[model samples]
Target: MLLHIQFSPEPIPAALPALSLGSETGAFVEFRGFVRGEEGDHTIGGLVYETYQPMAEREITRIAEALVVDHPVQAVRILHRLGPVPVGEAAICLGVAARHRAEAFAFLASFMDRLKKDVPIWKTDTLPAA
Candidate 1:
């Protein structure tokens, strides 16, 4: 199994991520989370995210590994943008590859659920629209 997890201050690239897939691989799934125009009841301009880097990466790695074997996943990649993320732009991306579609989707779902609860990445609302 392969795993790549990262946090960056730059905007996420628009191109899709690539994984070394063998003939046995039959499915690839991806997800992107964007900053919405509204947060709660207020119109939002953007969002600012913060993290401690090392500890956050460690926790994220642990969360992903726990589901890998059970989901029978082959490769996984994650990217989260720090600092400010503008509305309608992607703040995070996730990719998973597996030998079957069900496994790939399952792994994606499980990983996302765990990430929200366990990760230390924090988000603060940016300037509200005037």
Candidate 2:
């Protein structure tokens, strides 16, 4: 399996790296986690995310790697933005390529759920809507 992770201070890019897939890769799934206009019951402009960098990356990698035991994942790519992110902008982007759609979907769902609970990434602050 191919695993790739990237972090940036700038806004998450609109274009993503192509996942290298072979003929056996029949399904490719992509997900983008965007900053919403609201946080909890309050309105907001954006959010600032913080992470320990090394540990965050390592933990997320572990989560992805562990999911491989059940999913026929061919390639996994993740991109996360650090620092301030505006509303409607992407904070995270993930791609999963697998031999079948079922595995890809399951892997994506499980990975996201695990990431929210396990990863050290957090919303350090919120931007006031202007």
Cα error, residue 30 of model 1, in Å, equals 0.2
- Consecutive 10-residue window with the lowest summed lDDT within model 2: 11-20
In candidate 2, what are the lDDT values of residues 47-70, reduced to their tens digit? 999998899889988998899998
Where in model 2 is the C-alpha error above 4 Å? Answer: none
Clashes of 2: 0
RMSD of each: 1.3, 1.2
Q: How displaced is residue 122 in candidate 1, in Å?
A: 0.5
